[model samples]
Target: MCVGDGILPPGPLSGAVGGKVKFNTTLSPPTKPFLSVSWTFKGVNIITSTSVNVTSPGHTNRITLDRATGALELRSLVLGDSGEYSVSIIQDGGQQTQGNTTLNVYEDISGASITGSDDVLIEGQSSTNLTCDATGSISTREWMKDGQPLQPSDRVTFFENNRMVSISPVNISDNGQYLCQLSNPFSFAEASYGLAVNYGPGAVTILGPATATVDTLVVLYCSARTFSPAAFTWFFNGLQKDVDEAGYVIEKASYSHSGNYTCRAFNDVIDKHATASYSMQIKGRLAQRDTGSQDRGQQGHQMTPTPTTSRAPGQRAPDAPDTPTTSDAPGQSK
Candidate 1:
């Protein structure tokens, strides 16, 4: 039968404090005539149902007996009411039917929570303790990290009734969500805590090109490895850039853009930072002298020089190669 509250699902019979319990004993049809019915708690007779009304001192108001079924119902249950109970019924000619039942009473687990230090957990540098606490009947307490059981190691230990977990020095591997589970024969409850272990801003790098041509756009990318997301700052020639993002852009490359660029990554929780530098040299395009040489070729520089010839009576000499146009390119002078 359903009580006021604090009842668990089907399994072991259980009751809550201030609720009710029942000794589910059904009487067999009378073979002859009913004689006496009695109920005992822990071998101490607490009630007797017959023509005469008899009951234990304090149990009179909280207990009821059904003479027809030999069933006993207990109300206003308390923790001390839990124990072994027995029922016996006697009929004419001294025939008796006896049975025993056990009752376990528990209050609902409530106000379960996990507490810990709020400071940042720096790898190899910080230590902290997490405690699980509650207000009700907690027969067993368990610790879990990220949905898995949390095992104790050299740096991890439990004390104070296994309600607290202490880590001597936190590390990157210890970063995860933690939980506390509390349970009893009749009730269950849990609480969770998110644990963050601050690690390094490591392996800083620039991902873009180290050189760009004049009058061309270029972008420089920076990155780092960290346990938590990090803030990035860019620097050009020892001066910090106005932009705080990981990508830096130069609309047009010029000689003034040639210098060393540095990237600095900072972790928010711990006192750690990482830096990397890339030197970029802005290069000019091919010289105008080279372009001029190409134009001269198209005009006449590629033609064979005319050969000198004597002419008489206003006749022109035949034009032929005397000496090809002299070349002045480096290593090609002739």
Candidate 2:
């Protein structure tokens, strides 16, 4: 075979499976009006053309030849179609030219998966690592959170050519669904993961009456803001109470019930806790009304009435007037 002027500037070409490609041969101008051209793969004749007719194998129906330019076109390429393709051209008076090209065919991404620890992450206390695993030839990778693109910050980083992601000092806002996408020129695949972040019990509050009277019923409620619902505990005078619910009840408040009432809120996921307390006061039943009674009693003391006594039946009444017929004075006869 004789060498041509030169090969094309782009030496190699690539195509996806079931796609098309073209191999341009730098052919010199033929001196004669008629020329002979042939295309070969690894020294096997794939297509050949003479002045009279053209010939090709039965399976090469998708292959075509340009008689004037000597360029080869391949359609619906397969994995076995990837190889060196050469073209030879002959002119009158023994003039010859040749050119060669390499073709590459790649399969698409078929499947993908994600692998990492699914344990609970603590805010400002835990670290995590994740990896993306894909099948077939993947040329690119992308990461997303809750259907939005993931932007790297000081606490987030990527490694292993963007196949792995690392997170440090995780926070409560980082909880969401994460997606990993792998792609090639022909196909794409994706996988997902659910992330859970545990935070603290903050802003503890107790809701109840500040003051109560004796023999009155009262209920105290406790709550806090947290990622995980907090468990409640009631305390009286620094000692744990018998109740375990979020609400505490005093069936009958007495003077003994007056003390520092405290509520403790705790979260088991992050082992965080918060507390709130109220100095409760219990008063006597008559303490509030007695003040008004004393003020009215002092203003009407001068108008008090004389006291009278009641006598028993059959007994002479005290200071009773004597009848003329039944009684006699000391100076008169009866």
Q: Identify the candidate with maximal TM-score.
A: 1
For 23-66, candidate 2 gives per-residue lDDT tens digits of: 77665445554367888887888888886535566435787777
* Cα RMSD, model 1: 11.0
After TM-score superposition, the amount by which residue 41's alpha carbon in candidate 1 deviates from its true location, in angstroms, is: 3.2
lDDT of 1 by residue, 84-152 (tens): 777777777887767666778888899999999988778898999999999877889999998899999
Candidate 1 off by > 4 Å: 1-12, 25-30, 33-35, 42-44, 87-101, 149-162, 227-245, 286-334
How does each model score on lDDT?
Answer: 0.82, 0.81
| Cand. 1 TM to true fold | 0.69
Q: Which stretches of candidate 2 lie over 4 Å from their true place?
A: 1-15, 18-62, 66-106, 118-120, 212-217, 251-256, 270-272, 282-334
| lDDT, candidate 1, at 283 | 93
